[model samples]
Target: MADVLSILIGLMFTCTGCLLLFGSSISADVDDQLTQDFKRFITVMPLREMFPWRITSMNYRTMAGVLQLSSALLLLLTSGVLSTIANMVLMVVMGVAMYSHWAVGDEINKLVPALICFSLLMIRLFLHLRHMPKDKKD
Candidate 1:
């Protein structure tokens, strides 16, 4: 069951990653939309604000694409500790995204996707922990 779910999620992320990676370059409409969406967060996100320079929309797209792609690969190609770790990282990323949305006073509906990803990744982590072998304390 978990494997099936993981693969499904992996496929979703893979598609999203590919779209984000290439869509920005392939279509002016996609690039413009991505730029507008990303502009809202890069300046307001807490960690991002600390940087000396502003992050361009293109950079954000590439970074987000890479992160999604790596997470998808981890979920698809590996299980056990690697998947758990990947999910944990994803959870943090999504958490930050949610926070950024909140900080910017965006519509709550805009936050749903990040919240869902964060919740799912947490569940994935918990499931991994539940199945981990107990350490024998001799």
Candidate 2:
């Protein structure tokens, strides 16, 4: 059940990243929509202010989206060491995201998604660690 839930969460993140990266409507309209959506949440103010630069420059957002999608793909296709590494990498990306949000004074509500992803990835990593065999010498 936990694994299934994890996979689903990964899929959701993957799909959202894909949309942020390659969706057709990613021009001004989408940007505007994103702003409008964020405007509804006070916690999202910092992100809202950062949205235009973040989305328009197509640098940071694009790279993060690609990484996120790649991580999700790795988990879906191969659920072993490589997948674990990818998840760890994504955790770093999300950690940076959380930091940026905090630095900009975004509210806790705005930080929840990144926090959730980061937490879940950490949990997955720990699960892997817990299952590892102990090293021993004869």
Candidate maximizing TM-score? 1
lDDT of 2: 0.70
| Candidate 2 lDDT by residue in tens digits, 1-138 | 446745875797788778757655657787665444333433433354755553333455566678889888887777667777887888887887787677667689978998988888888788767776788999
lDDT for each residue of candidate 1 in 1-138, tens digit (9 for 90 to 100): 667767877887788788888885678897687678778877675576667887786787688888888998999999888888777767767887898889878899989988987777777677678878999998
Top candidate (lDDT): 1
Per-residue lDDT value at 17 in model 1: 81
lDDT for residue 56 in candidate 1, whole number 0-100: 81
All candidates: TM-score: 0.85, 0.72
On a 0 to 100 scale, what is the lDDT of residue 55 in model 1?
A: 78
Residue pairs in clash, model 1 = none
